[model samples]
Structure formats: structure tokens, C-alpha cells
Target: MKKSSQPSLLNNSEQKAALPCDHIPIRPGNFVADRIFLAKGSMTTPERVRFVERICALYPEAQLVECPDTPHNRIDLREQDNLARHQKGKHTLVFGEHKSAVRFSAEEGNACPNYWHFSPYGFCFYGCKYCYLAGTPSYWHSPAVRIFLNLEEILERIERVANQANMPTAFYLGKLQDGLALDPLTGFSGVQVPFFAQHKFARQVILTKTGQVEQLLKLDHNQHTILSWSLNPPELSERFEENVPTIAERLEAMKQCAEHGYPVRAIIMPLIPVKGWEKIYGGFVERLLESVPIQRLTLGGICIYQNAKALMEMKLGKGNNISQSLDPRSKIGDGRIRYAQPLRLEMYGHIVRTARKLRPDLELALCLEETKAWKELGIEDRMGHCNCLL
Candidate 1:
């Protein structure tokens, strides 16, 4: 369980009414769950009550389970064993209290430093085969998709932190899950974007690989929200990102957001070195630049956690390209396996060179790379301004 020490911004009078909970029409096939569960203590709060009412209205046929206790802990050993047996259940949703709603990380050696994120939802609806969450301790323990009901409290904490910073700080929304992947069901974007727009010191950065942006485009964002997309070549998307929107649809969504006066960015991450990758990536970048006015472009290659690497190898088969291409000399740091230093420089350098040549004014950065690697890519000066930051 995670706890935030930051004080709430709400007063007694302000807490009388619940925060906004507006329901929007979900894009078809955006989220389809067979089972829905609520934690026993979830209904004590008004936000949870409204969230439950919204979910019930959206999926009337889903079998709702009121869990006797929190799913993170088990009463006995036998129940824990049963959860281990059913790791692959499809279309399950759990609405619970996010005990650890806000997490602050100061990664000293990486590209994105001094970052904070909150989990309005856990895991993702879109099935990406190489997702790092699958190998994590939390996902291994309880792999079911979860949506938090304490969003109003979470945002209050974020505002307090941003006020303390006394600068134009960013509050990231897509670290633990796809930020907007389940928006069709949750309508979080509709509420969150407007809240950030009203704040004086904070901005919201929402990252997603999913192409659900109808709710976002309708909001009066006032350039306070940065709508970033995780993108890749068409061939890779079709092969790995099952149930996700196509590359064309994602590009169209980015274009639409840009047209709506929102600052847009793209992260071409987990850059797989497939056959003819250069030609594919080059063409994709060309098309992207021509289609949308991107504010920033961040590039990254595969950096998987050790447990996630083992799980991916198991799911993708031992003969998969991801496993076969991993450099044996690459040491594991922060419990993650990375490509060798030389290989990382080659990959990042290639993409950086290709992108800068096409658009010299493009803002480029790396994701989760060390200081030395940043210097090697000639982007060490632009360290803090990453995808999640301004």
C-alpha cells in the first residue's frame, strides 16, 4: 500500500459535494470486461459511490462482485494459491481504493528525473505482448485490471505538491497504466483535463498508445494538458500491440488533438531492431512530421525489468527476437535488463540523427537512459525536459 504525506487542499465546506463524475460515450470495443468487483471498503467515500454508479450504468450485464476484503492481501494460504492458478482471466474489472495513489521517484541516472505519478487505473486493457507490468511484483500478485475511486483526493494531493514546487511542474498520468486506455468507461479525461486547465502551477501529461481522444478534444485544455502518444511502425503495431488502435488511427488522433490547440508529443519507444527497421522507422517519422505539428519527439529502445524479461521470454517463446537480441554483457540495474551500452548508443544515435535531419527544430529526448548515454546522443543538455516533463 502507498501513502502520500502531502496535505489535502480541500476544506470542510468544499468536501460536501463530490468531485465531477461525468459519463461520456465510450468508443466501441475500447473496454469489454466480463466481471466487475468492488473492494469491501470502497463505498465509504462519495467518489467511489459515484464511480460504481457510472460503471454499473455502462456495463449492465457484467457480473459484479463485492469482495469481502482487499484483493492485495489474502486471509489464508489456500486463497492465495487459488489466485495464482487463474492468471489469464479475460475482461475483469476491479474498482478499489488506491492505497498508494501517489508515487514520487527520483531516478538519479535516467533521462526522466524527479518524476511523480498516480495510478487512477492499474494494468491496461490493450494487450501489448511485451508490457513490463506483467513481470512486476504487483501484477504477478494481482493481474486483474483495477480502477481507483479516490481520484478527487489524488488530484488534491497533486495540487498541493505542485504548489510547493513553485514552478510549472508536470503531473504524469500514464505510468502504471495506459492513461486513456479505459477513458471510454471512466471518463477521467473529461474531468482531469479541465482541473489541470484551471490550476495555476501544474500541467497534466497523459501518455497513451490507445487512440481514444474524443473526450479530450472536446475539453477547453488551454495548452495546460500535453497529450502524448506512444507510437511505432505499422508492422510492429500489427504484430505486438493486439487490441490497440492501428498506426493510422493513432496518427489521426494526434493530428486531431493538435488541431484542437493542445500541445502534442510522441514517444517512439521499445524501438525493435527488426529487419528493415531503418526504412520502416524513417518512413514512419516522415509521415508523422507531415501529418501533425508535434511539439516533442522522444525515442527509446527496449529496457525490460528482469522478472518482466523472463515472463516475456516465456510468453513470446524462447526463440523470440527480443530474447535472442539481448546482449549478454548488459548488466542488470534497477532490476531491469538493458541492451549493451554500445548497442544503445547505436540505436539512439541512429534515430536521433534521422529525426534531427528531417526537422532541425524538433525537441528530442530519451526515456530511462543514463547520463553517459545522453551525452553520447548529444542530448545531455535537454535532460529534464522529457516526455513526462515540460
Candidate 2:
């Protein structure tokens, strides 16, 4: 199917003038909201409008509502009043808030996880059986893709921050949705990739399992944009990641991106323990290295979120052999439930060792796991945010 085309939310000056307030402080009872920057694109649909209205009704004290008409950018919610009220210990935002409130926590203080998450669109169009969004409140509704049109403003803010920091900052795109799933329809990468490339302090990393990357390859992009693809074995991709690109097709996209001078990365994440798992994953890694010039690779074992576990079981079938093999575990602060630490370390070690044997120079790291095990691997220094950094 052809991608949908909508008017650029940032292009409408009249709409910008009509927005209630650029910054509305919403404080519903004791729960204070983060400052919600008004992006013209945020009100693209009636549902989105209703969502915003409901949030406003709930919280009347969220401040810093500046409405800039940018295409797809990040709206910082940290500036809202009652910031302390929003946090019950570590969790940010109640689980069952609004459609737009996909729970996320900034790595405040300490070394920020070095991972950057930017979502222009919320939820996803592709319905992967293993998708974690299904567990969140937003997933209960039809998957209507909402593009945050104020992306340009968000980019400008990010650029400003990066300029002041003057360090290599990896901003993650596609946290709330697939980074490139809507690229063909929205043409965001065309504008965003180059923008980040121009800034020396920022590296734009997009993670996707989609093969519709022809638009990206055709662009004369700066080398700073790292095109990372999430790969699973063919069996898993076929069985779990329904309606997405095939493993071969994804690798082909990565190969094309690398060929076009874009630095490429790979993520062997949420690794499911299927039949003949080792041989399947090892072969997949070998095939990946054979196809793309992987600058860095992240190895992650399958980690499900607790809230989503039952849903995943139902979708994949509870009696299925693979589901039966998955053991129950605790949820990390990031919202993903994982296998036991020991088992995860073993799997990570195996993948890292196998990949290192093939390409000694290949940068390898782990995703959202204990740092101590990574340190023991002698590859500790290589660890950074979300395997996109090497």
C-alpha cells in the first residue's frame, strides 16, 4: 500500500495562531504534568485532540506550552509543575493516563543512559505479535499513527542543547514507534537526517525492522545519521514480526545504506530462543556481517514487559513451545521484563564472542542490562546508550 500523505503540521501559520495557549500548565489534583510544548502537528486528529483535552482537564498546572510549528520533534515534558508529584518513586506518569502518555523516564542525574529517544509518531502501524505497545494503554485502540508536527522545533531545541553540551550525543528516534515505518509517507528523515549531520555534537540513530528505506538511501545525507536495523532470525521474523520486512529485505536495506556512505549499525535484540537457536542466530549474525559494514552491533536476549506478557502469550499462543520456554521475570525501570540475569549474560556473551571472532573490530554492546557483566566481557568501555554508539 502507498504511504499516506498529510499536510505538514508546521506549515500552517493560521492554526498556530488558533492554538489555546503555547504552554498550558496542567495540574489535575496532586499529579502535576510536565510542560507540554504545543506542536501544531500534535492536534492532527480528533482522537489526539480529545486526548490533549482530557489531559488538560486532568492537570491544570503544566506550564511552558510554546507552540512552534515544526515537523517532527521532541516535546520536553520535564518543565511542568508538580514534577515531583508525577513520580511515585521511579515510575513516571501513571500507567493508565492518556493515549499520548506512553510512560518514559529520562535517565536523570548519574550518567544518562547515553540513549536518546525521539518519537514523531506514537503507537505503530505494523502489528508485530511481540510488540510491547500492546500492553500499554494506547494500544487498546485502533493503531492510528499520529505525527508530532512540531518536530522542527524539537530538532531546533535538540540542536541548541547539543551545541551547548559540545559532546557526541546519540538521540534515539522510534522509541514510541518504528523510526522509519512512516518515512515514505512523512518524508521526515529527509529533513531530520541532514539536520543532525550538520551538528558535530549530535548523531541521529534510527532503529527499524522496515525495508522501506529507499527514500533515505537516495538522500545526500550527512554521515552522522546512523541507520540501524533490528534483526532476528528468519524464523522469528516470519512468525513473530508479522507484516514487517523479511530478514533478507532488512539486510538488503542495511547494505544499501552502507553502500550510500551512511554509517550503519545492527541490533540483534529481543532474541527469542527458538528451535536450533544457536545455529539460527549464529548464521543470522554471519549473514549480517556478510551483507552490511556494521560499525557497531548490540546483542540483546528476549526481554518481555510484565504487563504485556499475558497479551504476548495470547497473541503468540500460550501453549506454543516458544512461549512455554520463556520464564517469568521482573520488569526493568524501562518497562521491559527480561530473562534471568545469568541467562541473559550467557546469551549476550555467546553473541558477542561469536561476532567478535568474525570481525574483531566490530563494536559490540548490550541493551539495558547490568553493566557489571558487560564489564567482565573486557568490552565494557565499548558500552554506551542503545548499541547505536560504539
TM-score of each: 0.89, 0.70
Query: Taking the tens digit of each residue's C-alpha lDDT, what string does model 1 give over 1-390?
Result: 223343443433533223456575463365677677776556777766866776677778887777747652221212243223224433667777676677787565355587888787887777676777766677755666777767777777777778777677788888878888878777777667777776677798989987767878888988999989999888988876778888998999899999999999999888877777778888888888889899899887777877677666655786776676677556444435677778777877877788888889999888887778888888888988889888
Residue 233 of model 2 has an lDDT of 82
| lDDT values, one for every candidate | 0.74, 0.60
The C-alpha stretches of model 2 lying farther than 4 A from their native spots are 1-114, 140-143, 329-335, 388-390
lDDT of 1 at 183: 82
- How many angstroms is residue 310 displaced in model 2 relative to the true structure, after the best TM-score fit? 2.1
Off by over 4 Å in 1: 1-19, 25-28, 45-47, 71-90, 106-111
